[model samples]
Target: MTAQLEATQVASTQLDKNTIRRRIAWRVAQEMNDGDIVNLGIGLPTLVANEVDKDVELLLQAENGLLGIDSLALEQQIDLDLVNAGGQHIIAIEGACYFNSADSFAIIRGGHVDATVLGALQVDKYGNLANWIIPGKMVPGMGGAMDLVVGAKRVIVAMEHTVKGKPKLLQKCTLPLTATGQVDLIITEIGVFNITQQGMELTELAPEFSIEEVQMATEADLIISPHLITMPTPH
Candidate 1:
């Protein structure tokens, strides 16, 4: 690369919010295993779909009853009647199926969902999650988060390292609980963590951040992994 082009790239660095979110989504996409039946929560988690490995065969299900989701539909290809759990337009693959809310929840609550990716307001050392509601604020009622966390075989929290510089990974959640002792893993712009019987483990660090920086951004105690890896930035 020429010096001028390198300078242009540096000057065009994405705003932190966009950078972190895209990084989290891309990292989460890599965590999916072939043949897994995955449920994606709204917002950042939905972004994971487009980043999934093309060769990986996994079904994406939305709580709103659509399954075998192919991708988020382009504006031109959108069907008026189809959408994901977040009400965002999406494309359903050939074998896609739709059902009533009853059957949808049945698929999740029946323990058929292999994994669920969700965003959280807070995650604690004990694998507890709080993402539903904040005190003294009017908001949409907690959707299916509680059920998803409880019912899915694996719960993954895909969120930024912090909320506007405030640590969202805490020693204990300060907000209303979505589920307790449920989250299996967390992916953020700064690192990847796993909730283990011993506690939260920092298994990987982003190439741009130091271990000290990660700890400073987290309120939960971290058990550093023996085989820590550097997380590559998404192109």
Candidate 2:
């Protein structure tokens, strides 16, 4: 691709290796149908708000106590009382509502959300997700991950292809798990993989990355999509 087209793609759909993490979150948001109730975990999952259509009727649920939340914009001043689970500033739409954090988790545990997007630290070939504190190492708590993973109708993981330059997807996770066999799909900078009972199937790879390249990156065996297609470059 020409430099100009590359720049256009980055500006339009925000698709590129540098933004791959965000693109995964964006793709997860795009998967939502009208009226779908969705939960977004902290970190990369928070970026989904920027990619969704403003009029799609999708309700955003935050573990901290907000629903139907809107994206924070620089054009608008910050609202101290409105924040997401990560404690980041967020805006609320006209029909948005707030509840207690415990109640918010209850909503998730009750399977009220159609889907959830979360960041993963490590995902095994069997769909097991590990995102909590790595024992003996500095790490954050699981927060609401356990509830969301098992309760959501579907769980999508948005994360980088690697952590500290090592592949995050592997045959097994080295850290304590957030949830067991709950992840449905993983979208990463290298590719999109579907975790099924059989194995990790590669559905799509980043435009500049090849299947061999992705396989070399991960420790687990990869199953390429029979209907594999390259990602569309942004206009």
**Top TM-score prediction, candidate number:** 1
TM-score of each: 0.92, 0.88
Error of 2 at 230 (Å): 1.1
Worst 10 residues of 2 by lDDT: 1-10
Which run of 10 residues does model 1 get worst, by summed lDDT?
Answer: 3-12
Mind giving the per-residue lDDT tens digits that candidate 1 earns over 145-220? Answer: 9899999999999987766447788889989998899999999887899999999999998877667667777778
lDDT of 1: 0.87
Runs in model 1 deviating more than 4 A are 1-15
- lDDT of model 1 at position 228: 99
lDDT tens per residue, model 2, 74-178: 446687777888988887888798889888888888889999998888999989999888778865667888889999999999887765446788898878888
Model 1 sits at a Cα RMSD from the real structure of 6.1
